[model samples]
Target: MVSTSTLTYSPHHLNAIVRGSGFPILCLHGHPGHGASMSVFTDHLNPRFQTIAPDLRGYGSSRTRDRFQMTDHLRDIEALLDRLQVDRFLLLGWSLGGILAMELALRHPDRVTGLMLVASAARPRGSHPPISWQDLAFTGVSGIINRVVPSWQWNIETFGRRSLFRYLIQQHTPLAYQYLADSGMSAYLQTSGPARNALNAALTAGYNRLSSLEQITCPSLVMAGEADRHITADSSRETAHHLKNSQFICYPNTAHLFPWEIPAQVLGDIDHWIDRHPQVVASSEVSSQ
Candidate 1:
């Protein structure tokens, strides 16, 4: 069963969901989205690990908070851990969330047991903006579709694909097709809410803080899709280089959402790494028959 709770983070209440029971793992989402992005991992975790997926402050059920800097997000994660009374758990971040997880590991190493950065770039180089505003435009449209005609939310396919537009239309219900165009317009008119401004600030801060990647010291896994257009393979390689101990993996023919498309392979790699870690192995050996 899924357990949902409201967490009071000062000015606003953030919604958090936890399932399974054992070691805690915090999962983050990407730009223009929320913790639901971690839905791909819903069925792929080790039985010994409990999963904690939160709607980041500015998205989904979480109330938008002030101070959307990378540091701010890190603090939020820390507080969330404190609320849960958990210590030293693995951190997984996808896309924009990957950057956030990286920051969390760098800033609060004591709280992170390991790091997994999925389809994340070390630096947002080149003319393209660090976070795509265009993607947000489409995401906002999709959210409005959810609010008006909730049933349309059922067909949110192709989350781990580059061609969101094509998949969305094909899977959309009759009402969703209409709501995306209509309700999306209304939602756009009421834009610039706490979430938008907060995310924009976070994006700008992320671009500015790209150089701090070298400070990370953890067993890290850097993953990227072979066909990720936003952040190319070159940047992902650069990201891996910055970590003290890291492994880089590229999923062939995949886009930014690798875990969603191939959860088994992704989870298997993660399990292998965790099992091979010196501390984990040492502990297991002591308990073995």
Candidate 2:
């Protein structure tokens, strides 16, 4: 069973959900996604590992602020870990969350034992051409509109939300779309305009660690879908190339929503990877040693 709780971090609060037991793994969701986005991992990973998924500030149940900076987001993760007394553990990040995981590993290597980056890019936007036209429309046009529109005006119209959701669903495979729709993820994707703007700014501001990828020393597993329109497979390959010890895998006939489209395959791969890298352990063990 998954347990939900709120952790107060002075001025703001983070909603977190935890499940299973054993090695602790912090799961970070993508932009416009909350802790529940990673909840699927719990269903497949439980009994072997404890999954801790939290809503990032300004998203889901987490408190929102006027401004959402990368530094602030980083602090929130740290604060959540401190509150949970988790000194070290593996980190799994999907899409935007993958970038955050890389940042955390770069900034605090000791705190991260390993990294699992799923359908994420190391370079900032515009670093390379988008893989498809749908990618361009979604990131270039819709992204701008979301940033410019007022929060009150955004998602207020049923037609607008439905249209956007439809487009988003169209990007995924039929199986993936079905899973997302059944999980009520379509509603969750309707984020406030301000939050969307904040995320867009963070992503496009060009403050990235692509150049510093060689600095990451931890073992990493980079997975990407060959058909992912949002982030190209080349990005994942580049990321793996830079990491001292890393593996890259591309799912054939899969897209950005591979987590939902191919949950069993993804989970199995992750579990096998973890088994090969058995050094990843609980925080208490590291402290005891």
Candidate 3:
């Protein structure tokens, strides 16, 4: 079962969802998403392994100010884990969350038993293709609108009271779309405009992990969707290549939203990776004594 609560950490208060028990796994969601966005994976893994998902500052139920930086996000995660009493465990990051996970692994490899990156790259927006004129125009307009209007009002005007199921699940097969709807992911798309803007700025700032990738010594898994437009499979391959110890997998016909599009497969792959690393470590520790 999933339980929800809030944790106050300094200037921010993060909303978190926790489920199951035993070995812990901290799940991080992507941009324009919150902690609940990992529900599909967490629901499947619960009871077998404890999963803690928190909405990053400036997103979801997390409280934030006008601006949010990458460093602040990293600090929030560290404080959250400390408060939760999680000394070390696997770290699973999807999309932007993956970058944060890599940052954590790089900064504190000893605290990360294993790492999983889904549809993510080493650099900010590294896998994304060149922006088209239409995309640029859309962005310009959105930025102006976001700056002018309040987040809740703008969200209501643009998406109305209905869910964002249709607007986000594009390019995927009909079956995938239906599956996402069935999974109750519409709510996951709800986020404040400031949060969205913060993420956009962070991406535009051109953060890269190319030089630091070699420093990550933890066992890592990188999964990419072959058809992902935002983060291409090549980026995932590149990231894995830089890692000293890592495994990479690319799923054909899968897009950026593979976690929701192909939940079972993604979950299984993650489970296998965790079993091979952290679980193996636990077994060896027992045997050694």
Score every model by TM-score: 0.69, 0.77, 0.77
User: Which window of ten consecutive residues has the lowest lDDT sum in model 2?
Assistant: 1-10
Q: Write the per-residue lDDT of candidate 1 for residues 1-289, one digit (tens) a residue.
A: 0012223334334466677776677887665555554656644663567888877666666655353433455556667778888766787887767877877776676557678888786574322334467566656655555456544534344221122433323224434344334433433343326657655654565463446766777688888777666566668878898778888998876555456556678888878887866342222234344
Report the number of clashing residue pairs per model: 0, 0, 0
User: Candidate 1: misplaced stretches above 4 Å?
Assistant: 1-12, 65-70, 125-192, 205-211, 278-289
The C-alpha RMSD of each candidate to the native structure, in angstroms, is 8.1, 8.5, 8.4
lDDT of 3 at 242: 93
Question: Model 3, range 33-144, lDDT digits (tens) per residue?
Answer: 7887788778987778889999988777885655655666777888888889887778889888898899888778767777889988886344344556655554444334
In Å, residue 234's CA in model 2 sits off its true spot by 1.2
* Alpha-carbon local distance difference test for all models: 0.61, 0.69, 0.70
Query: What digit string (tens of lDDT, one per residue) describes model 2 on residues 22-97?
Result: 7789899886687877866767776778889888877777856465555567778888888888878899998878
What's the CA error at residue 225 for candidate 1, in Å?
0.6
- Reference-based TM-score, model 2: 0.77
**Given candidate 2, what's the lDDT at residue 244?**
87
